[model samples]
Target: MSESGASPAKIKKLDPTEEVHETREYDPETQKALEEIDSCQNEIDQLNEKASEEILKVEQKYNKLRKPNFENRSKIIQRIPNFWVTAFVNHPQISAILEEEEEECLHYLTKLDVEEFDDIKSGYRIKFHFDENPYFENEVLTKEFHLGSTGDPASQSTDIKWKEGHNLVERFRQRMQQGEKGGTGRKRPLELRSFFSWFSDHGDPSADEIAEVIKDDMWPNPLQYFLVPDIEVENGEGDDDEEELEDEEVDDNVVVVEEEIEEVDEEGVEEEEEEEAPGEEDGEADE
Candidate 1:
């Protein structure tokens, strides 16, 4: 669909080209060898297909095994304040698309779940559960990706019913429109797009980079992301590094002052000794 809420034009005009595919002529012996190579490739493909089936069976079994654990983990995660949002924002690729408002909006997100369809290879869906918030009316928003029987990939999402004046997606669109009209403080680039748009997006699901990142990277071990801030502190990777440097500078200044004080005290004692020696010499001369 186009940005204006309309489907794209169906007609695809092909450019004129001289390129053509042609099979190369080979000698009889070479052709026989080629046929043998093709047979070998077919066998390899058959083995690959069998391997895929076995892998899917294993995945299904494990998914069943992991269900109880995931539920228990979710129970604990709900106790933490803004757990999902924190983890989502800590994710490198996911964070890139999240603007300030989107980050705040995600605070309402209570839980997140991504489920593979029964076939596993056919499709998957990501579900977002939210607390009562000002952004929208939906408690749970879902986006599904599917591979059709014909092997065509498609995506669909729950329509976000926005609360009055709280649609960040619409806000972004308005900002883009305004920016086009030469009214702007700063315009977001294509890369820094709105998160809400991503949620509602149905285009080219197979190419959805954030979806893959969340499913493969963020979902499997969200605890790592939840502990991202602590991890960074442990690694000396943030503003704390500057603070440590400042403390060192303060310690050096204190050492310099102490040394100066010791030098002054030694000079004072030397002066007192010189005065006492002069007084003793005077007393001896009088006697």
Candidate 2:
């Protein structure tokens, strides 16, 4: 239509091909239902987002409160000499699990550190540092625990290694010589095995047994302290009640069985008495 375009070059149309498809038109009721569903979904999404934001805020507040408290605790522990030793010794549950020979060596313990590697894999490394001791040449010993995907301690793997100190190698050599003379040679110090075993044993324990373990300071996880509530107090009472109920049920069954046995005995005695009476009457009549 333009003066220089010659009728707009004849407008071209899109020819329908096999790939072309028609759009479906839903009925009024179905369209309304779909709209309602979409509205509900949007509402749910909004509520979830709001809830997550609130939860995050609460978690942030908790962390802010926890940080200072933890710092203060660390300061207090640092100020006290032999604090770790005293803490472990004072706890009856922890003391009971340790060997008598280990008590002296644990006194030399200067530091205990636990590190977690969650990025590469789920695992923990426990490091223990001790002062100069006559036992082994290693001042620092590390034990690692590699956990499964499910975080089960029963399926964990462990590795033990140590760094050599100045006097440890010489002391170990002397011990080996002594042991060789006595016809008793050891590959490693028994103390190392004992310490590792104690820690590893706590990884998985019976529910009742684990309660005591978690209360001790030796438990590496600080989160464990606040995360697990004191529900065991009520659970203990419930367990006692269940035990009492079971005992009562057993007693009731025993009483029922005894009553049935007494009834059978009484019936047999009555029949014997009836037969003896007839014999006596017949004998008297003959006389």
Q: What is the C-alpha lDDT profile of model 2 across 130-239, one tens digit per residue?
A: 77775555677665555546655442323333335423333334544575321112233333323335544445532324233432355434333322334445446448
Query: What is the per-residue lDDT of model 1 for residues 123-235, given as tens digits with 9 covering 90 to 100?
Result: 89999999999988999999999975766799989999899999988887787677542122234446546678888877788799989988888888999998998998898
Off by over 4 Å in 2: 1-76, 119-121, 150-196, 199-287
TM-scores for every candidate against the unseen true structure: 0.70, 0.35
Could you give the C-alpha RMSD of every candidate to the true structure, in order shown? 11.8, 15.5
Model 2: lDDT equals: 0.53
Evaluate residue 122 in candidate 1 and report its C-alpha lDDT on the 0 to 100 scale.
88
TM-score of 1: 0.70
